[model samples]
Target: MASPRELTTPATLTEESVRRYREDGFVHVPRLLSPEEVSVYRAAAESILERDMEVWAGGDDGAAVEVNYTTQVWRKDETLRRLALHPALTGIAGRLAGVPLRLYSSEVLVKEPEGAPPTLLHDDEAGLPMDGLEQTLTAWIALVDVPVERGCLSYIPGSHLRADSERLRHMTSFEQFREPDEVWPDFPWRPRVTVPLRAGDVAFHHCRTLHWAGGNETDARRVGHGVIYMDAGTTYLPGVMDEYLAHMEPGQPLDDAELFPIVTS
Candidate 1:
């Protein structure tokens, strides 16, 4: 386990890992957080979800939502904010991206045992409200050990190389309302790489990489923190987050310190 001071220090990445990210569009980093760090984050996340978050249900059944997420969590809890801005996290993200990055958003995701459904396979680029989409990525940090049966993430290797226009078209036309196994008949299929992580492990994937997670079968909840990082000059576009970024011009760069701060050491 890393000492408290070491947890705040910038993480070191190897050339092999950077190369893997460039070629595969995803890379896993082991022990990104210490055991002590995980305990603190897990407690903070659980408390925030229970007390502050209003989890939204996806279906029209009007069922009471008891699991899932709160977006931009960094803006709510100081402890979670520290996790988002942690030097190790930002440093690893910057290194993997091979460029300066700006924080786009951070979310806490939870999949309850036995009840949560499997997340569908999709690329973030299909839904993101940003220009220069190629330069965006997400770092998913596990707060607890996530085995295959406990909702670990899986990705189609190198799928990020596909054209963005095609992905968006297919997503809008065919994937809007379907189950995880359901997809457009012509959608290209590839073998997936399932990534199981220890409590402190983190996996970084390109925004365009096709990915999904399995439902938790174990008794414990599968909790994760995902932080999206984009190129420093990424500009705003009209979409899901329009209300939040309404102050900025349609094509304006998202440089606001409060919402989209630069990830620095």
Candidate 2:
């Protein structure tokens, strides 16, 4: 395995990259990690998975199928924490956001074999009171190869810039948006492109990007680990933000606590 510095270049996002992002709502960054780093994190995750299975009883497929390991990884895994704060990503995030960035949270999303369901298409901002678009972003890193047949992510290009009314109709989750079919009755469901990623590739998407991941149809599992980033000066929405902040001690900033601990300043 190569060092992260050796594996990734110092990404200087161009106007075209920014323009594409503004127009498409997301961009796929290829080969963001070296094979070595990918292996380290995957092994760490596999260790946790094995432990979870051993400690917990009753290996019912349905119960095991729905599991999503996230918070625990951030709390106990150093390798994952390092990956969350990788310089290549944070620098690009800062440039894209035009401000200092802080890691908001990290999660491990595992779409189990065969029985996993399709995730609803929606924007992250629908559930929060964000004042503007540039304040929040997400870096979704693929830990294994993901093909469309194996439940790769699909997005509606340029939909991030759509009006609230138009956007709302495409979201169907508790996140406060309608399903895509409801919004675009005449539009065909064909994806613009199926984002195929190698183990180390990462995709950076805006908070408002309308995206979804289908179920894992193959025998092998599809897994992604996401580290959400927010511009340092961004404020938290009062009601919904309170739930995550409640666990913090008085006077402690939200980024300083365990839940949204700042992996990078």
Q: Pick by lDDT: which candidate is best?
A: 1
TM-score of each candidate structure, all chains considered together: 0.87, 0.76
lDDT of each: 0.80, 0.65
TM-score, structure 1 vs. true: 0.87
- Which of the numbered candidates is closest to the native, going by highest TM-score? 1
Local accuracy of candidate 1 as per-residue lDDT tens digits, 13-121: 6778889988889998888888999999999999888876656555347643334787888988999999998889888888888777899998899988876767867
Give the CA lDDT, 0 to 100, for residue 244 in model 1: 78
Q: List the residue pairs that clash in candidate 2.
A: 170-178, 171-177, 171-178, 172-178
Give the C-alpha miss distance for residue 264 in model 1, angstroms: 4.0
Ten residues in sequence with the least summed lDDT for candidate 2:
53-62
Estimate, for each residue in 1-265, the C-alpha lDDT of model 2 and write its tens digit: 4444454444545667766776787878777777888888888776666555322221355454443555545656788778787788777766666565667777777777776666656667665433333557888788888887667787777666666655552222344445655765533554554577778888878887777777787788777887788756555444333455554454334455455544345
Give the distance in Å from residue 89's predicted Cα in candidate 1 to where it truly belongs: 0.8
